[model samples]
Target chain A: MTGPWAEALPWVIALPLVGAALTPAVAVRRPRAAGFWAWGVLLVTAVLAAGLVSELLARGPFSYELGGWPAAYGIELRFDHFSAWVLPLALLFVVIVPFSWRYLDHVMPDERRPPFYALLLLNAGGMIGFCVTGDLFNLFVFTEVVSLSSYALVAVGGRGLAAFAALKYLFIGAVSSLLMLFATAQLFVLTGSLNMAEVSLRLAEVGGGTAVMVAFAAYAVSFMVKAAMFPVHVWLPDAHAIAPSPVSAVLSGMVVKVGIVGMLRVYQIYYGAEVLELGAFNLALVWLGAVSIVMGAFFAIFQDDIKLMLAYSTISNIGYIVLGLGLASPYAVIGASVHVFNHALIKATLFLAAGSIIHQTGFRTLSDLRGVARAMPQTSAAMAIGAVSIVGLPPTAGFVCKWYIALGAFEANQAPFGFALVFGALFIFIYYIRMLNAFYFQKPVHAAVAQASETPWSMRGPVVLLASLCLILGVLGGIPLTFVEPAVLDLLPLWGP
Target chain B: MLLFGLDLDYVAVVMLFCVGLYMLVAKSNLLKKLLGLNVMETAVFAFIVTAGMVEGGDPPIMVAGTSAPFASPIPHAMVLTGIVVAVSVTAVALALIVQIHAHFGTIEIDELKELP
Candidate 1:
């Protein structure tokens, strides 16, 4: 809350990084000890993270030059409500990461557990760095930090299909990262400053240029690829399906949401109102968001594998964010933004719950899970809450996000997009209802059922807690939206009375 | 025909970027695709160094008798981070590729997908 703590901003990225480095040092001493220590480190980080967010909110948008130098002369790290929100989620993922270690150990061989936790912590660092840094090149470096670690994580979970899938993901992530770096270089050439604020200022001076638009497109496409938007989403289902459940949850919840955040940051900073208005980027966003909604749903319905079904469903839900982005209005953008927070909580819960079932029963196919309800009532209950929230049902966080997006669409006079909103809701119903029905009605009699008892409390507790939060946040939504609304208003043209 | 004495350096870097991007897009081999990515990254690094080079700029590192910080030091520092990232990616990518080989017994994209 003090005036700029220039030295401290990078420490937000550094805390988890230092924790990651120390993880193996401690873990190698005693494998069991590593998990508890990791959780404590992450928990302290979550507290520190809360302090930073409060500081950022009080002071307004804050930038710390990485060293003592002025922002334009050094890599600048900036934080507002946007990056502020992303940092905590990354930290919380670290908090719950140990529970996942227990779950993954059951599914993976002994060799992977230590490395997986190490990669997970490193990823926490990378994701934080990506969100907090205001320097364009730093953003690219952190993107690699997350990607390379994620690719390794994916390989451990999947074998033949997963290996190939990881490769595809590697290719896509590599290409996008290259495009991102190139775009950053282009900006550097034009502006002579890698600092985001200065870049925006200089670009405004140059104004309406081919190179800027190309750079914008490059950022947007890269973000979309990472977000797993439909069409560009070829590698996603296989990747998610093959990944161990915890990895799947993290990939779906934290990893992809980071991409959406990145794109929004790019637009708000680089494009702003001046270039955004000229580009009509809103129209283009709406266009893709619309297609991704319907197409993702259609694809989701055809998947026999439950994870694949959820994977496709993830693509559909991301469309809502895309649509909200396309709406580019304050309320709509808020809808999209809040949806990331809301959906990440709900989706992670569902995947963890589903993972509990998978770890217990070794069954992922829908047909294979006939009556899992009787065996693991708690996981099933969490899944139900997650499914309900995801469907935008009452008293769940998903509803608030949908309500805003719908209002945004109608407000924008984009009725068809409004229709797409409702249709997306219906698609949520079609797939999730089937999932629920399968859980309740389908008999759980597969061969994996004998070993498929419920997971221990460590694994189930995080899912349950998040599911409960989904319920509570939906009903008393004013608190969460307080941060989101202010952020959203900053992006809007027609905001305020 | 050259704009500056540095024209060839710029052109060569641009060509490397194009070649790498093409291989990244067009190549079917997974290893080559990753190689292309590294190639592209190096090309970008080269271009960035060129941008930092002014008419009389010299190496960024300050040593004995090195005065006045002739070249842009910022880009050089940034490239150090970039190179670290490149190496990290290459290590992870090659590791994943090796695992893929163990599982599918081939590194070719077409061959891996042929089963499913």
Candidate 2:
């Protein structure tokens, strides 16, 4: 627990943040250097994250106290099985930043690249910090860091509509963040501690009450907004779709996971305390999750814009995770956790591939992009792989976790929701089938699309690599379960009545 | 002070929070919505500061005369951090608003929606 790997924990979060601050300065003389600089930063962070995960495997969960302070008093950074997410999260950024280098030629001028990369790195650091922190207040701070940077990143593409979308995102996002801060303060007021473990212990001593329930409700609503669950999902589509494609991949793939991760942190606290009956709440989540699934895919079926469809699909995927969590069975929870990782891979592949096509043909709508597969065959093939994977076909990454979640639905004796899950997947499959048909079978409506050339290798490389990983991980899907199962087992005992 | 058996300060905070929410939802002006957000933040900060107050307690400063009943300093620290965050959010919101103004020539949600 006290080895070099343990020592690397703080540096994993700090490196990206420091690198982000240094980006503009480092690239001041040569603005193009910012992209390479950000990539290098994330590369090292991914390495550190891998080392930390290895340490977790060798040992169990470990903790690090900031400034030599003890656990109850000092801010603690704990890396349990759940925190293993940082490794993939950082690796996704490593892949994404490179794609953005050439992608930015269409997004903004060279001078804007530094700030764009900086915001992206800030976002990475914030999420990494979010996943690792063991203090409630620290969680709020990191959420703001991520939220603030995300708002700017959405508008960073430079358009009036982009600014408007970013503003709407800011209003809703800032409110959710305020709710999170209020919840944190409420917990602190009730327990007189900000450390999550300490707060849980104190809450156990205090037992359940209206105040505690209110705090939990606040956290729940806040996270649901962040996750873009059905009711509060209005802000997500525009903000996600309007952002540049690389930003879309990051936002859709990773940023939204913050809510799910934060929810897990709250569950760790409340479940550990054995406070408030969560049965009714779980039922509500199951119902809402089902609705989100249908609604997300239902709306996506109507969208012509590829990125907007992908954005809606994110809501549906989040629904699957929420439903799995609500099922409260071990299989369901494990599936949901692994889906968190797999969906990121699948979505990033789709977005990057879509970005490449758009970059080549200057087309975004499916009707306008017909027969694009003829011109950019590799990118289209990658997009097809992504589409198949997202629809939960066998031997693809999305299938594994979703199959487990379906089993979990039946295991939890929720036969109806299991059916719902299947139907949701069918709905998802229909839209993707439409997408594939447009890409491969149709004649090009726009001459520009017909004459479009393939993207540079810089962009095509990431798309192909991610698409291959989609298949590779589909076959090797059990890898993430090794990290997820123990974590869910640790949680399920106190889950509910 | 107590209002209907609840602390008046808390009642005030809740009322202020509702007022801000109303402005954020009901008002169309983007700037007004931003101000409303700041007001809501202030209310939450006030609630935290109020939670830290001790009955007739001295400031949480340790020189020689500090006693056991000193006000909790942690809430102050939290509020200070919260204020800094609020300021940054406000700054970002304002910047976005400026861009919207430039692009659409309107900051009212109603007018903006009518354009294309």
Candidate 3:
């Protein structure tokens, strides 16, 4: 029997692809209409995504095979807690599209608007597709789709450094994708099946060999680069800095987290079975995460550009997620998953607010943007809310995930990592305080800031919405923790008794 | 079937991957770097396509009446999709290089750094 959830599942993937196609065609005739059109489409996708989430909540996790074909031969799209990310992913796009309405006209020329929105929609669809698919090769295809669109989106920042940054991003991103494909090939060669469930079953039988370990390394490094973990995160700061504001929000907020989602899936496939020994790998993740947490915050403090600082902070936060996942305790997994969700909201709010500041004031650096709060009170306030949450302060979203991770670290007897998380939070706090000092205490340093106006309502609205969400989700941590706990249990049942 | 005590095809894949990676890292020219990326992509594709090979096997296409071990077609299909992706990336990259040249007047990564 066909259920409503089944009817709606494919539409979540289909609607945006359809909308992305129609955008440029609409733009050819009515260029001004493209932004509103995309917003409408994303709004529909958001509703469908929410429906999927509610259905999953009511019915538990389920998989839908495409085209009436069985899962082994055909593509399977799963709607477990991991894929439930489609809800927030789609809603984030809904927030970003309206923000782009005025921001695009403010930054770039008129002719590029339609194509810009098209790429944005396409990127969103790719990410949602990436999360929901259960087949291994489909993961690679969607990752490529997201990367190709992101390269274009980064390049669309209007000449000069934008093109170079996009090209560099392309080179690094392409190599990472190739590595992942190589890894996928290895898994296929070993298991003779590309479906994740089947491969997981087969990998258990022929496990613990040199070739398998090599494939594991390949997948780890490939996904780490995508997550923008410390060492390979060179491409992020410049790319995010040069991109248009809404694009920056989307990239920092959602796209990078897609990599973390990939890691979660990888862990499920490889770690769920007892054949592979992850002791060394998990320890490596813990230490690498420790280094990332400290080093990323250290680098972030030195960045003068607002978006660049936010970008570096992303690496640091990714460290926390990785650390928690490495611990492999039930609490740690829940913390990692919640942090993944929390950081997306906090960073998106921060980036969008920063974009608004740059939009109204034309200041890119803190030294030039002193006393921005006086002119753009709402935007700066939203930025402060994001900053508080990101710093893991009390009564905000960031604190909840950090708390769980800290408890998990101690429970797992990884006290050093627990301390690292604490020290890292202190370091993050210092820079955010510095930022606040620049915003409120210091006088307007540049002539542009002195003449700046408040951000438009269309832009200000989403920032406010996300900022408040940071508080609401923080106070109600159990909402996401509910979805997170079961998913973690299914993958890693090591937290016995 | 083997050279230097290693499978020849696998050896070739490793050499190609390393050479491509080296050029990507060491080369300063934008076009050369893209070339390196293409080489790396090709090497990965080669490894994948070779995995589908069987000893003394025929192509997967079925004849009227014959029983023979056939090479797997799945990897071949995957490689075809990969080749198209590689081409699209290369086309976009070359276009970006053109734009970079027009804007900064140089295609060398070092010289672009010197531009104001």
Candidate 3's clash total is 0
What lDDT score is found at residue A280 in candidate 1? 63
Report the lDDT of model 3 for residue A351. 92
Please provide, for model 1 over A325-348, each residue's C-alpha lDDT reduced to its tens digit, 9 standing for 90 to 100. 888667788889888888888888
Candidate 2's C-alpha runs over 4 A off are none
Chain B TM-score in each of the candidates: 0.84, 0.96, 0.94
Task: State the lDDT at B74 in candidate 2.
Answer: 90
Count steric clashes of candidate 2.
0
Residue-level lDDT for A397 in candidate 3: 95
**Candidate that beats the other on DockQ, 1 or 3, i.e. the better one:** 3
Candidate 1 has a DockQ of 0.65
Report lDDT (CA) for all predictions: 0.79, 0.94, 0.88
Tens-place lDDT per residue, model 1, B32-106, is 988888899899888777777766666767688777648877677778888888887788778878887887788
Clashes of each: 7, 0, 0
Task: In candidate 2, list every pair of residues with a backbone clash.
Answer: none
Q: lDDT-based ranking, best first?
A: 2, 3, 1
Give the winner by TM-score. 2
For model 3, how does the per-residue alpha-carbon lDDT over A107-132 read when each residue is reduced to its tens digit?
A: 77777888888888889888988988
Which of 1 and 2 is the better model by lDDT? 2
By descending TM-score, how would the candidates be arranged? Answer: 2, 3, 1
Off by over 4 Å in 1: A1-8, A272-279, A447-452, A494-497, B1-14, B60-69
